[model samples]
Target: MTEQGQSMLNRTVRKRHQLSAESIAKDLQISCGLQISITAVRRELHGMGLHKRAAACKPYITKCNAKRQMQ
Candidate 1:
């Protein structure tokens, strides 16, 4: 990744920490028109001191669901 691309990736991760390599690659392609491989993205991220992390799965509780659970 170029310096600009790296900065873009850094900013992106800062804004949303839950992004995967595949999604980040796709976003770069769509937004920056940069055709990069998933492995390349991973390598660049690793070079930038970023690593893979699994997002925590949390169920969304609507008001109705919250009320039902409280019963």
Candidate 2:
């Protein structure tokens, strides 16, 4: 995995929080100088099992969004 990828995972664990793939990808590009897409970030997070967690307000929203976008 890329250093940025590792850092992303670490941040998620440290914060016990998850961010959207777009947010992570933007951070990687702007902060870490890594040019990657949200889709790539999503794939990486899936491989790491570190993707966004369910939210209290709309528990399945993220999953639904992912499915829609992928479709």
Candidate 3:
């Protein structure tokens, strides 16, 4: 990514802290005409000290919801 692109990426990340690499890549493509791969986005994010964390575990159904469904 160019310097401007990198700055844009930083700005984007700052503005939306929960965006994924694929979405960020698509944003860059749409907003700035900067075509980048997900890997590149991830690399840039890593360089910026933004590392990915494992997703939190979620139950398929909450206990309360499951009980309600059974009624």
Candidate 4:
């Protein structure tokens, strides 16, 4: 459990992309034969200060910016 948690923690913290807890739990079950739950994966990730978040979006798109971007 701990080794899996460590690997996931490293990946979530160091990588530009993130994996969902459900997928991680599936991987742990398939790759390592550990039948852990999504909640467990979330708990483990939370222990390492990782949390799920959505990518930030810009609310405003100015006409000048759009014109420049087309070029």
TM-score of each: 0.66, 0.54, 0.69, 0.55
Clashes of 1: 0
- Which tens-of-lDDT digit does each residue in 1-71 have in candidate 2? 67756776557545645568777777667766777787877877787766566736855558779899899
Segments of candidate 1 deviating more than 4 angstroms: 54-71
Q: What RMSD does model 3 have? A: 7.2
lDDT of 1 by residue, 1-71 (tens): 68888888887778777558999888888887889899988998899877777669999999999999999
Comparing 1 and 3 on lDDT, the stronger one = 3
1-71 per-residue lDDT for model 4 (tens digits): 57856785456446535658877767667765777788887887787777897769976779998888898
List per-prediction Cα lDDT, in the order shown: 0.84, 0.69, 0.89, 0.71
List the pairs of residues colliding in candidate 1: none
List model 3 lDDT by residue over 7-66, tens digit each. Answer: 999999999886599999998899888989999999999998897797799979989999
Best by TM-score: 3
Report the Cα lDDT for candidate 4: 0.71
Order of models, best lDDT first: 3, 1, 4, 2
Q: Which structure among the candidates has the greatest lDDT?
A: 3
Off by over 4 Å in 3: 54-71
